[model samples]
Target: MAFSADELRVLRRALALALHPAPLPADEVRECLQLAGSVDEAIREAGRLRAFLLADLARYRTALPGSATGYLELLQDALAAGYRPQPDDLASLRSLRHLPLAAALLARCQGIAERSVRARLARSTAGPSGAAVPAAPAPRTRLTALPGGRADIKPARPAVPGKPAPADDPAKDRPVPTPAEAFPPRKRPVPPGERREAS
Candidate 1:
């Protein structure tokens, strides 16, 4: 963003006044405000131009083989403006290497993109010191010792298919005999009838 000689003067004066406090003349204050507004407008214009360039770059990048020349120019411009190439950009550039400019960009961008990938891979697989970190152990499936192992001293019993399971005793449900039923009382002799005595 190039500032005109008059705008630069206004900005310089504004800064000088800030450092050395003084009552500003109304005209000078107005000039400073105008310069600030122009700066803001310039910033907004730059942003819009960047967005437009990126959009054009992406369009050309996709239609490669057809838009090789335009894509190469736009890519160089974007790279000059500090736009980092993405993985997709690298892939597209790879196919366009038949062109000299496309080949140059492909070489440059592949190095950067590959380095980024390698950095990510290193971070994922290693610790801060760069040593290979051990992965967590998987959970064991069998909780008890395996059969026939020294850890299991007792042999496992096999199921007998022909043998029936033992049932509860039926005598448990029968009632016990009472004491009166266990013994019988003795019978007494009967006396002579009163009618026989009278005869």
Candidate 2:
């Protein structure tokens, strides 16, 4: 919010008096109150303006290609005013992506949406105290031999550092057998004697 030179001087004096904890004369007290009122009014006005801009953006978005140009301009203004792009806004932009400005804005809006999702996920994953919780370590993996000597790798849950692993866990006893190992390979009869005689 922009303040006049007179208002700025009053604000400065009020800040100084606040820090120093001094009593102000009747006139200075009145001026400080007036300045505070002005600040509150300015804040309210900004909120109203932002609301109006968003409403306008929604109206334009609903009107689609007919209001494409006006809608794009309003969306740009809304973005500049710190408005988050909605799914409808993304869809609208995607439909209008043939326009150069619309294409650029679509990319920008997609990035904003992705960042918003990531921020939301981060917030959700945060601890009660608002600190970020560390991600769990990746599962451990090991290679196990198959029937034909081919190997396959499978994930195993890492044992807790201080806790003992379960005794009944089959994975702990041995690598889990594959289907090929569960059933033996079939054998085929051979005519080796007759082939050797012909040779």
Clash counts for the predictions, in order: 0, 0
Worst 10 residues of 1 by lDDT: 164-173
lDDT of 1 by residue, 13-37 (tens): 9899889989999999999999989
Residue 129 displacement in candidate 2 (angstroms): 1.6
What's the lDDT for all of these models?
0.82, 0.90
Best by TM-score: 2
1-199: candidate 2 lDDT, tens digit per residue: 7899999999999889878998779999999999999999999999999999999999999999999999999999999999999999999999999999999999999999999999999999999999888799657788767786544444555788899864544556788789899987887765999779889
Worst 10 residues of 2 by lDDT: 148-157
**Residue 125 lDDT in model 1?**
92
TM-score of each: 0.54, 0.66
